[model samples]
Target: MTEDFINYYRENISKKSQIIKGVNDFLVWGKSQKINFAICTNKMESLAKNFLKKLILLSFLIILQVLIPLNIENQIQDI
Candidate 1:
C-alpha cells in the first residue's frame, strides 16, 4: 500500500498529464470495482473546504504545508 501511494505521488510529479489520466483510470476502476471511498481527517468540514478552495486558487501552494486558521469560538455552537 505504501509503495502504491509512493508510486502515485512519483507519477503525479513526473508528469501532470499522466497523473490526470491515471487518476481518471483509477476512478473508473474504483467505480467498476464497487470500491467505497472515504476521507478521514481531524479537520472540520468547513476548514477542509476552505483549504481546498485555497489550494484551487493557488495550485503552486503545497497543500500539506498550507495552514488553515480556524476560529474555535465560531466553530463551537450551542444547540
Candidate 2:
C-alpha cells in the first residue's frame, strides 16, 4: 500500500510538488542559526529525497542527516 502511494506520488511530484517560496532563504537562515531541518512525513524516504534533489535541496538534507525509517507501522494490530 505504501509503495503504491509513493510510486503514484513520485509520478506526479513534478506537478504536485514545489519548493515553497522563501524556502531557500529560510534554509540559509536556519543554517546561519545552526539549525537543521528534519522532514517528517509518512512519505517514503526515497520519494522525499528525490523531491528534494529535484529542488536542489538534497545537499542541505545531507547536513541534517536525518532520514527516518520509511516503513514502520505504528498501529497496534491483532496478532
Per residue, candidate 2 scores C-alpha lDDT tens digits across 1-79 of 7556656778777676677899998888887887866766544456666677887787665333333443443421111
Model 1 Cα lDDT, one tens digit per residue, 5-75:
54454444324323344654665577577765444444434444444444342222233332324564354
Considering summed lDDT, which 10 consecutive residues are worst modelled in model 2?
Answer: 70-79
CA deviation > 4 Å runs, candidate 1: 1-21, 47-79
Given candidate 1, what's the lDDT at residue 40?
Answer: 46
RMSD of 2: 6.1
User: Highest TM-score: which candidate?
Assistant: 2
Q: TM-score of the candidate numbered 2? A: 0.57
TM per candidate comes to 0.32, 0.57
